[model samples]
Target: MRQRLTPVPADLTGTVVTPGDRRYAGLRSTYTTRGTPEAVLLPRTTAEVAAALGYAREQGRPVAVRSGGHGLSGSSTNDGGLVIDLSALNRVEVLDRATRLVRVEAGARWAQVAAALAPYGLAISSGDHGNVGVGGLATGGGVGWLVRSYGLTVDHVRAVKVVLADGTVVRADADREPELFWAVRGAGAGVGIVVAFEIEATEVRNVGVAQIAVAARPDGSTLRRWAEVLRESPRELSTAAMLLPYGSSTVLSITAVVAAESLRRVRPLVAPLREIGDLLDDRVDLVPYPALVPTAHLHPNVGQQPNLTTNGLLAGMDGGDAAAIMRAARGRHRALVQLRSVGGAVNDVPPEETAYPHRHQETLVVASVFPPHGPGALDAAWRGLADRVDGAYVNFESRADARTFGRAYPGPTGERVAAAWRRYDPDGLFRAPGRLPDLTASRG
Candidate 1:
């Protein structure tokens, strides 16, 4: 028998979509998991968001909050529950061109945000993919194309407008509601529904981009040289590398983004990278900053990409650590491994200033497994790398287990994050499943 959903509230009469509704098909799932929610509430304003939250609470169902529905863990959608979809509330406006302070709605994709700010010669350092939601990336750590120069997207957040579990709307910043503001920067999933963010944009009209592919040796010497070039290079250059199977061996494919506007300056910075190994391919171009994350990447999420992903932070990739990464990519399971240069402007921020405290790490390593493989396969491929990694990033992780949370938060950061979550949301309404155990007891 089909479950009967409660009648939609008068305020949400036109906004609610049920199973039989034609719109329900598009709103039913995330990027990684398919969901069958009883109803999906599409709110266009902050007041409507508050109403939607109240309606979900009255239904007595597990509630999931979705911004752009691109979350890797699939926590944005639930099997049989209510989903507060915020895609309609997307709006980007420049409050002050002098200060480069821009207000962005949570529902907006990074592509839309970049397009909106292009006219004003302003841009936020969002993720590489244009389809990623602004809320998810900004709240968590944003390791983007200009990350080494401008830092994480969360680092530029000036304030946030959030709707709490009790349907109370509040604005948090450095001077007001400081604790809530701090928690929202990195560990926001457990606190409340953030409707919008006020972020400081950078002045960037054009950037130099280089796409290079080189032959990678099995012993990890090539990998070490790649890291060495990034560490010694100026803060203006940031790169993302992927280890891929090339014929009988693996090749390292890299996309290097330099913050300079002219090719004259970009060539010298990336010259060292080409000399690392036998170059398979190399290309450089000076394109508009918006081109890096173009609107062409935008698409609806209907569980199109299904993969299990995990990541770790490295203070520095030594020969042993580098070999472990290569081995994981070439192992029996053949997990896909990717690396991002971190530790430029990212490390300039003190660890205690925000919820994201992995400030000392120099590189971000991510590994993923697709179909025909499960958690065991992923674990087996990652076993050799488990000890070498110093920390983990919450956004890339597919599991919401206690162990994953510990690695993401670690030591005093975890304790403080737990206390803040409890203070703001005592009933645990927004907590991810199995994410918040008894941390004090676990530590003991």
Candidate 2:
């Protein structure tokens, strides 16, 4: 019976990608540059998605949902399983201006939504770059430029429509399925495939942004200084620091952003960085966030390879930790070290209240570098390089880990979210790496 689905549906009004098709290969390949899927189902509507899931469930076929295909994990593909391409459902709608709310399809990009909301003087709290999908980003503990002030991408989410393992299509929000809603915020991809999202938009206009890069300091003194600065900076301003090395020199990239309210008056705050080092270039200007993305695109590209990253929260690390990282990065691939200044609104909400942890941590440090394919010795080099760091980022973990997923969230949030996942998916159908497992016991 499942063989009938092999042919492209003529009446479905959406594209169906099957094996042996030219487009099938590209559609099935994940952005991680890893594995490919067996078959692809592109559904244009929520009902179509439900139907696809119904078909898969009846056939007892394992299924994986593909959003951005940008996830670092292999969640979007299977060796021989059904794959749902949700990018077909990508849509964004302005619900009401007075209410400051919008409905976005699961496949919509942060750039698309921000562009859609610019005319209304409103925007959702989104991540740094514009290319990332809102669905996966929000579900994986979204930490964005606006997070320090407004909160996470999930914090603004009002509701989500999901297709569960049993082919159940349900809408969950703050007031409806509150338990599932809480879990959906952090565990949506694991619990089910989210089709749409309702989010609260923030009022923002001309904002101040600064992109500064300087010659490598003797130590991370300047980088650490930036971290301290971000901690006390007004909530209106957000900052992130990156250490990049080229040849014998390393550059400290400090990016500072001020919310619209302080757009015109942030020079006093940004001027301190100029004195921190031998300045290379500083571009500080006032512009709408929608306009800032052009500058955001200038940095490293996550698509070049399968990214392996180690990320965690730190209270306060002296210069010694920086030295250890530098020593660990002695080879060809210079590790791009990142330390996010996390605080403000992120701390006001209790960690257990949501699936996202790392709220109380004063700062977050991430070590990111992609896999290199070369001489046989390179594999050992990469493995030995990662040994210098501890643990992995949920967003960047090679794949989901059932045993340690609970540890990703702070407090008892992981266990609480696991219970909600059971109530929703019940079967281990939607499970992915770096996320909780499906509620198989409940389904049994």
Candidate 3:
């Protein structure tokens, strides 16, 4: 039930939007969908966020937090609850030019960060989608154009400013609040609201964009060979294979980015992929490191399209797995299958070092169908390749399977994340949608 809107806090610096408010509709909308949130509080400061959390607790209303509102699971919006919109907190500051230390507010998008850092010839490894929120992506393992070169976004995180469930603000990092720091890196949705991220940006001038189009079918051998080629490729080269649906046929399109200073140096590394199938188009060009992320590809304006997605982390794809994936693609009238190459710098970090435990996985596979087609076929296809599936990336994840969550943060990492949840958010105010209860919350 929607709660009655109380008088706005006079001392609150940000805007409190409720039902019937002029901006309510716009504020309640996220990337994938919209929600009927009772109240949307746009907080400009950490203190305002804490106040809003306290207000939500006082009103006995569920709380949801939104940065760029790109969460695939729609965790940023809740029905008849308080949505703490952090869009006003967008700010990016370069702390150190020498070390490339930068402080980015949680609400700041990757495009804003890229634009801010480009003048300095500095860039943080982030998702290819420029409009993707810095907070959500960084927290849930960012696999971007530079995955092979710099590693996941969490790898470069120096620190984080988090607002606890009890409205307490704390700074977490390797030394300060180390446990919380570890949890915030990956299993971030369940814990608390992150206010800012202190990232160690890397220096890069230019990157090479590699694109190859091949007319393909569900032969299984084609995709298997593509995976093999990527596995042996140089660290500078990172690639993603997309199964694009055209009428009744599906085309296998491979796109790669070489995070090298020049295209001449990366040609040998990415040359073998051209012979994978009947090549239709091949283009390799040099551009600014930030320019590599195409705005059109992000699909920021996903209006009414019902996007059903499933993701899995794969160690290696055999012919059987590839065949299953192809069959799944062919079965669906429209299936968006994306397999991102993630091994070099991403796997370098040990699973135990952070909450993101799938370090040994070679590729991140995400399959989606818009407008809600045969949804069962998607899951069935994923199940066929279940043996090679170790874990799932939280950013691309929409399912709430206990086994999948267990795989995502396995062993001690799971235990530690639960511990952090209990320690900071005992009330379970920020529990992810369809997720199990936090340890302490369950006990209570």
My TM-score estimates for the predictions, one after another, are 0.97, 0.86, 0.94
lDDT of each: 0.90, 0.68, 0.79
Q: Looking at candidate 3, what is the lDDT of residue 233?
A: 83
**lDDT of each residue in 1-444, candidate 1, tens digit only:** 545677877887789988999989999999888888888999999999999989888877788999888888888898788899999989999999999999999999999999999999999998999999988888888999999999989899999999998999999999999999999999887778899999999999999999999999999999999999999999999999999998779999999999998999999999999999999999999998889889998888899988899999999979999999999999988899999999999999998888999999989999999988888989988998999999898888998777888999988888888887787777777764633443433443
TM-score attained by model 2: 0.86
Give the number of the best model, judged by TM-score.
1
Residue range 138-225, candidate 2, lDDT tens digits: 7776777766788778877888898887777888887877877787776667778889998888898667788888776546576566
Which residue runs of candidate 1 sit more than 4 Å off their true CA positions? 1-3, 432-444
Over 1-444, each residue of candidate 3 has an lDDT whose tens digit, in order, gives: 545767667656447888788778677767776688888888888989888888877877778888888887776777788888887899999999998999999988888888888889998879877878888888889998889889999999999999988989999989999989998889887778899999999988888878888766676777888888888888888987898766666677888888888767877777888888878889888888768654434433233444767788878988777887787677634457788999899888988888988888888888876664645756765666566677888788666555556767767777788778787787677774454344553332
Q: Which stretches of candidate 3 lie over 4 Å from their true place?
A: 1-3, 247-249, 294-304, 432-444
RMSD (CA, Å), candidate 3 to true, equals: 2.3
lDDT score of model 1? 0.90
Residue 191 shift from truth in candidate 2, angstroms: 1.1
